[model samples]
Target: MSTVPLIRGYEVVIGLETHAQLSTRSKIFSGASTQFGAEPNTQACPVDLALPGTLPVMNRGAVERAIRFGLAVGAKVAPQSIFARKNYFYPDLPKGYQISQYEIPVVQGGKVGFFVGDHRKTVNLTRAHLEEDAGKSLHEDYHGQTGIDLNRAGTPLLEIVSEPEMRSSAEAVEYAKALHALVVWLGICDGNMQEGSFRCDANVSVRRPGQPYGTRREIKNLNSFRFLQQAIDYEVQWQIEQIEDGLPIVQATVLFNPDTGETRSMRTKEDAHDYRYFPDPDLPPLVIDPAWVEQVKAAMPELPSTMAERFQQEDGLPAYDATMMTQSLAMARFYEAARDASGQPKLVANWLMGEVSRRLNTEGGSIEASPVAAGTLAALIGRIVDGTVSNNGARQVFDALWGGDTDVDAVIEAKGLKQMNDEGALAAIVDQVLAANAKSVDEYRAGKDKAFNALVGQVMKASKGKANPAQAGELLKKKLG
Candidate 1:
């Protein structure tokens, strides 16, 4: 049996609550535009402002997006779900109470699976509910008084709550990334954590191996995954130290300061009763029809898990490569296009994971934004397969392709990248290598493998890198015998 990872003799339990802002064009309860970066109060409708005579009308697009998320996660879309008013007062909230889902959320009970290192981990989701986002309080731009940006207010959000199943910060980040990818894959959200399109709150605690659960402190608004991991680790250590010194852990809502790498208590964590949730009178019960669910499902794209399985069974890729390829929808489509064009699955996986991913990361770009087209990459890989270019030659062609040159064969010719595969020419060079490196040949004949590799390198160097490395190695072995 596998053991849970312990930090300083304490098992860390982490639960994550992620908010994926729906990519609707309008607010959840009003006709105000939901576009970000708008001027404060410019986008706030009367309903968002909670004016005297305003009532919120539900956005069908927002509910459809929630249905999309639910179908993507295999969660049950409650045929009849009610919205409730969660009583709270803050500078950013125009209304004294916020409309949210309390007991009957729209999406209920799902599992998110992701790989942490080599181990596949899964976290159970408690519920995902539809709600309106609170406005942003801006303090930096104003001199003494804070300004409120109600543009984000009334924006649609699907608040996904997870069970306390993650044991380490790594698992939590992986789960967050998987869910982020899923939402982006489903086109429900943009998955931009930096822009606040998606955010996560981590509930963390530490306990000894068989003891009752420790008190959990909620870390609010971990906007980045890096911060999410750092905050949880720091909070776990602090809690363990407190317990070691015979001090009790207090439950509270905390904020992670990325600069200090520490968590500061914000307020005492509020329980359900503290919020005083009651069904909202302004909004009626959200009733989704079974046919609507089917329509959404029919339009849904294939999920990552299903695509990964197909990559494994049909393309003969390993689980790791399959998972990596399915990290995003665009990447999966790119890999499939290249693999089908080249008729090489493993080679396509290697190139994408190695050269393609490395180049994209170095430039801080995404696969969707890559300059090398799938068909172009396929052509380059095809050249390598047909012995038209060596592996090094393929890299040269790929570089040229990324730099805006499209014709693979033309680039190969201009760069003198075609491998020297002619039998007579390569055999003559192999003979020269064998004759010049008698000592190395003796070592290889006497069973040293490194000497054989050295001889192969010398032959390639002699041929000015035109000789195919594999062909040289085979010919060199034949000549030695």
Candidate 2:
């Protein structure tokens, strides 16, 4: 069993609901473009506006994307799924209801696997349903009147609902990231939190260990992973406090304010019955053919987990390194190019996960935006392996290559960072150091290891760090003997 997070002796349980905007050029039910940042109501068509004479036509591209997602996650794509009218009223909703899959969703019963610490966790998914997004409510620019942007109103979304299996905020964020990576990798969503292409709502509840599940309050629209963690942590503590103070934790929807780092109640939560979901009279049932599913499966890219396992088996990398190398398709591709070019898979992995990843993170960029190319990094590692440069000298070459189009050999030559591999020259330097440091040599003959190290340091200093440390150590040992 998975361990639950205990805060002040109470267990925190969490589930997530994520909405991933499909990458179709057109909206789900209309020919309206799903483009972002358009003028309000300009993108809405007759079907999106819910005119009396209009009807919705399902976009084949959107359905194909959903099928692609189901294949990627190993979920069951129902042959027949129904769309229902989710009855609700909001200022931004044009039709006074949302067209969504409620009772019979398109994709059902899959598990997303992620690593939390060292333990591999699989969060069970309930369903991923196709839904039409509502329009946005714009308030800041409108002088006491709200503006509705219908550009997002008819956007296609796959609402992925997870079971209440998460035990803490950390696990929840991991689940979110894994889901985000999966959808983006499948080319279904862009995974842009800033633009709301992918967003999560966390349902949090606290109770005694082994007790019945407590009432859950949903924290809505956490667009950032950092905000997701903060919101859940605060909500868990707030619920525990409420129980202790003899206050009932009411079931309601709340919004997280990132600046204040707190969540405030928005409105009372509604159950499934409150939505008044029913089969849409206007739209027919969504039927996916088995042959169509097979076609999508044939074209699906290799999943991340499958690629990670292959890395372990072929590259001899540890589990963690294999998983991290497959964090994104770009990163994995980079690793492959470097490894093939250098003929040193392990060395390439080291450089990528070490210096390359560090610089990318510091610059707030990704592997796709890296300044160092795979061939250039491969050349640098080759120099190190051929004894042309020490690990220290290779770093110098790497620094010069980063953010520049300079050649590896040019940097090595310009900086004069080549290792002194000449056995004759290094032997002469070792003899001079030995003659100059007679006391150290005597101390070394007297079985003092530090004295021997001092003599080796003298050799490195004499040659100005050009002499390879391994060669120096060997020459010094021969002279002392």
Candidate 3:
């Protein structure tokens, strides 16, 4: 649970419904290709088009992916689940209805844990069901006419519904990001927001403290996390303004306009009865054996939560650092490779979280696309550990490495960035600094700590920023005594 932050004296409540496009190659019922960017109507087979004398056949890959997702979240995987036809009339839906799970979904009762800042929070899930997606109605490029693209029709989807537990927009974003990472790590979804492989719809409402739940409006089809946060913020403010002005908040489906940063009503929100859900006569009930679940569990990769715990116990990383290291499988692999190569877990963690992360963010790249390799970074960390270079010098070495230099030692020598470790040379420099700053030394003898720091800075300046700061302080203190 998260601490609910009040917005203008009202508590903002939010939940999310996410549709993850499964990674199966074929449609959920038909043999049509489920690939994106295909020519319109070219990939829709007779079954997808709802032609006479055609029957729907189930895709086993989609069901297996659903099972994998249920197991990953520690949800209950029902042995038997029924498919229902949700009656809805839309031009893009050739069948005039969607096949989905209603009463008995395949996955139920799970939780997703994430971090908002340094606090850990958990959001419980309501259900995750399998469904088929609708086709797209393209309104552009048809010269005042709409074109229907059936390539996405009948594609496999897992609609994960969450409880209304999020207290703020930041919590909602973190929860969505965690769910996205899990699906991609489980190999069930591609997790590409730009390609429409993953989408989110947020249900937002606001209520006074200790009052009943407020009327929620669904903000639909948020493809980016930035839009998700912005939409919720505007929606919350709008609802509060309406209540303050003696206007009732209406229950409707809304669209987020990124340009204006507001939400407009699309249609009145419908309940389950409005769709007239009933068991589908064409498809039989889905059955999953206990043995199948066991097999899938055995072949599954290590989960991110488990891996984070392992990093904490074995490598002595803090909880935040461990969580960051295991954000994605590629990132975890990168951290482990660097930690193992350098034999310095803490140092490696610091660099990855600080310098490496800053560089990656500035370049708008992912860990997988990092220009610096793990081995090269590990070697740079080794230089700092063995007293070969100071922290500032290491940054210069990293800059060279990122710019295409391969040899670490060569870069260090070329820039003259090596630390001044010679005992006699450093002692002589400290003595000279003491003589030059006699007034500062007298101030230090009078119990002024700032004067001591100034004297050390003068020593570093005399040695041209190559002296070990700790050693300089020690030599300065001894000479003054």
lDDT of 3 by residue, 1-481 (tens): 5356899999998999999999999999987888888888888888877788988898999999999999988999999999999999998998999989999999987899999999999999999999999989999989999998888889999999999999999999999999999999999999999989999999999999889999999999999999999999999999999999999998999999999999999999999999999998999999999999999999999999999999999999999899989888999999999999999998988999998899998998889988789999999999998888889999999999889998899999999999999989999999888888889989999999999999989988998989988888888888899
lDDT of 2 at 429: 94
lDDT tens string, model 2, 1-481? 7356588999888999999999999999999999888877899998997899999999998899999988877789999999999999998998999999999999998889888876789999999999999999988968999888888888999999999999999999999988998898888999999999999999999999999999999999999999999999999989999999999999999999999999999999999999999999999999999999999999989999999999999989888788778878888999999999999888999888899999998998989988899999999999999989989899888998895956999898889999999999999999899889999999999999999889878998999889998889998887777
2 versus 3: better TM-score goes to? 3
Off by over 4 Å in 2: 1-5, 428-462, 473-481
- TM-score for each prediction? 0.95, 0.92, 0.97
Range of the 10 consecutive residues with the lowest summed lDDT in candidate 1: 1-10
Winner on TM-score between 1 and 2 is 1
| Best-fitting candidate, scored by TM-score | 3
Question: Which candidate comes out best when scored by lDDT?
Answer: 3
Native-vs-model 3 lDDT?
0.93
* Order of quality (lDDT): 3, 1, 2
